[model samples]
Target: MHISEGVLSGPVLLSGGALAAAGTAIGLKKLDYDRIARAGLLSAAFFVASLIHVPIGPSSVHLILSGIVGLMLGWGAFPAIVVALLLQGILFQFGGLTTLGVNTMIMAAPAVICFYLFGRLVHGRRAVALPAAFACGFVSILLGAVVAGAALMFTEENFLEVTLLIVSAHIPVMVIEGMITVFCVAFFRRVQPDLLPGARVADMAAPQERNEA
Candidate 1:
């Protein structure tokens, strides 16, 4: 999902860089003090997960695990993902330094969106949470593909075919991520529910709800 260097125009790169900077600032501000340890762990998970990629045609699909990051860390995913991607870019050259901003946005923006959209459902109850977890995983990849594709199309009209092909290649990844998210969420929900953002919110709200009642 990384946009290679020199593919995007200066304006596109600048705008993406600006957006990523702003997002990273917000993410750092929003990081919970008590959850710092958990955030680091998730960051490590994200860093490792992307290493194993399945090359398909012109695009390579990998286990982003972005949904789990967002669902657990909220806006914190931006900073965490940035760190991981930075290391990946420097060490492995999976993506270039020039395209770091756009690549981070492509992956982390959808994660934040999923946190807002499906987070509550994932924390609601087991029956509802499983499906919501699945949806979060499924939708994040789809949204990331759309954003990346749109960015590419904006840079060059001729990239239409490549955009479509990349999007298509990730369809399998969407399903894989969904199933993985479900199992991961279920495990956390049972073993360490506090690690999840939704669970934290629900737990905090319970006191207020009970008092009001």
Candidate 2:
């Protein structure tokens, strides 16, 4: 869902960039130094995962582990996603610098929302984590599609068609992302359970002291 440079008008682009900057600041403020390294590694993993594409009927789609990132890093996923997108743009031109803010917001907003809502959905049920994570991934892609559609609407008259196409292209990919998110969450549950934000926050004080020590 990378919007190319010049796709959005200057005003929209600047406004989006400002919002992205604010979000990045908020995310950075909430980041725990103890988890920053892990977050960076996971964000890089997520960036690479996007390269693995699957062919659908008319379009190709790739995995975006935004939900997994959200589940692990909470609000920190914003800056993590921003860093990944910036690197992707600089290194591979996967997205353009002018459109970076719009693209980052499209992906990162859903992640932040998912991080906030997943806790309510899962409550104290460990079994719900995988499903919640999968749903978050699905919703994130849909939100990204919506943002792309909105951007197109400002430039192209056939906004509905573009939106439909983007959403349709993501259907199969969403399933794949969901499955991957579920599996990743389950694996983390088994191995580094503390890596998840929920568990980490519950034990935050101890880790903070350990890191300071």
Candidate 3:
């Protein structure tokens, strides 16, 4: 979801910009060179997935695979999201430059939250991992909607209806994203388990290998 330019108040925009800047810094700090490729892949996925949008007032409905991005990249989701959003703003003008910080926070905050909440659970057995994956996706969208709604409301009370509509509109998307996350998690678990959170093959090497490296 993205909040169009000029919809948010100056204070709201400043706050969002500050938070996004901090998150981006932490994401860059935590991001290692080895995970750069995965981050790029997910950033591209996010950029493409959100390209098809159904505009609803100032916001829009789209795939927003932020949950999957977060599950794969952890705090790195911040920088990855910023990159995609920046490109979208620059190339497509889908979201304007003035609103980039708010949009990035809207998507990336829930992503980072989901990463911390469900990172470990995804490594569990199928029975547990599947549900966690679903929840991760579902909750990420839900929180995003709330954040977007709150931003609008804080900007102007007249936006209450739009806020409600935005949340209502994304209900189906939340479930769809949940199922998509489940599928991705399952597929990755089989073919590239190392891609999932806590499953990095390099990190799991034996103590001798670690010392040698």
lDDT of 1: 0.86
When 1 and 2 are scored with lDDT, the better candidate is: 1
List model 2 lDDT by residue over 112-167, tens digit each.
Answer: 88788774443346677767867877887787777777777766766679778988
Model 1, 47-94: lDDT tens digits are 887777856568766688888888888899999989989888788878
Per-residue lDDT of candidate 3, residues 1-213 (tens digit)? 789888899999999999999999999999898878878887887788776664556776668888998998889999999999999878988887778888989999999999999988998999999999999989999999999999999999999999999999889889878988999899988898877667864456756697899
- Candidate 1 regions exceeding 4 Å error are 32-34, 53-61, 205-213
Model 2 bad stretches (over 4 Å)? 54-60, 119-123, 201-213
Minimal lDDT window, size 10, model 1: 53-62
Which candidate order results from sorting by lDDT in descending order? 3, 1, 2
By lDDT, who's the top model here?
3
Residue 163 error, candidate 2, Å: 1.6
Q: Candidate 1, residue 156: CA error in Å?
A: 0.5
What is the lDDT for 186 in model 3? 92
Q: What local distance difference test score does each model get?
A: 0.86, 0.78, 0.88
- The global Cα lDDT (0 to 1) of model 2 is 0.78
